[model samples]
Target: MTPTNILSVEAYFDLICPWCLIGKRHLETALGLLARERPDVTVHVEWRSYPLIPATPPDGIPYRDFYVARLGSPQAVAVRQAQVCHAAREAGLTLALDRIETFPNTLLAHRLVRFVRRQSGAEATAALIDNLFTRYFIRAQNIGDGQVLSDALAECGVDMPGASGTPVRHDLDWLPPLNGPDDLPPRTGLGVPHFVFNGTHSVSGSRPPAALLEAMQRALARAKQIATRTAA
Candidate 1:
């Protein structure tokens, strides 16, 4: 197939969401599995932004309390978190929920990611995303602080303010509504870590890579059928 015939998928995610991280890993695993079977098909990805808890305060708040109030009772929250932790471990990922004191506004982090995207391609962007997750989930670092972000960016060879010149802060207003055409409404106006495949099919929440791969294959197949019909 021609390069134009290749498939492209856009993913919307937030760094703070544990399920998003698991979903990402599962997608990667699915891609690797697909590669072994079909090497000819090219799958391209674009990352978008979706803040799960946009109101997350700076300096961080107690994540446990936040979940309890937002989700249910403290005991219920703990149980839910345990389930997530198990899922993460099953996915070969370590989730340090204790370290996440509060969910900071991820607008700045998303901007930094966009900046990294500009400096490096998708692979680099993916690496940076993974690194950010590791820093929070594994190291339990405070990612809400500018200094912490600058340090992380610097480690990735990404230039940030304070390190070189002025520090760059993200504009939250401009951060959202970054997905598609200027007029298209956002999918899952509330849910985060949304994945839109071929700009047609959208999967809300973090899904397994097998699900994503299947979505891509379906999109590709439909496109091919349309092309064949038009030609015939």
Candidate 2:
């Protein structure tokens, strides 16, 4: 049976950040395990936009050059991203850190995700987000281009129209929620991949699948108690 109470998780991340990819994979693993153990926990995930380097241009920039000029050199950025790749791999994800070509402007991608969220469900949007990250990071594809995004959306069942049509520009928005350098709630002080259990409890970061399962179980129990009390 479908759980009456839905668990909502707001993920604030940018495609350029490799940790974000790791976080997503861990979350998916947690959800899959939960589905097997407790079939009643309904999860609804929302993708929020968070730019790692907002000053970067929309046209796109060579990732190595951009990082080297800001930090040190191409080798240094590679070393850092390599750590992220290792972490992701440990969490059962494959990431190609060395082949990253450019850090494309992801504002448009975020807009496309939001548009899909409005039309499709949260699960579909999450899948699309995963695909975009993989294409850019692993396959070294130019996801900054609108044509690529449009095609990806269509492949994910979005049915987007032309490049400049409504489907492409519908969810393009400038503002994002929880405005700040850190993405979290007002009181919880959490981070990205904030798993909100029935709008109350939350777990941040790339957590273990077991921990996520436990959280879902607790949330389900609490929801049942609330319903029982209401009926009484």
Error of 1 at 221 (Å): 0.7
* Top candidate when judged by lDDT against the true structure: 1
Worst 10 residues of 2 by lDDT: 175-184
User: What value does the lDDT take at residue 72 in candidate 2?
Assistant: 88
The alpha-carbon deviation from the true structure for residue 96 of candidate 1, after best TM-score superposition, in angstroms, is: 1.3
Candidate 2, TM-score vs. the true structure? 0.77
Q: Rate the local accuracy (lDDT) of all candidates.
A: 0.71, 0.70
Q: lDDT at 66 for candidate 2?
A: 76
Error of 1 at 38 (Å): 1.6
Q: After superposition, how far is residue 119 of candidate 2 from its true place, in Å?
A: 1.8
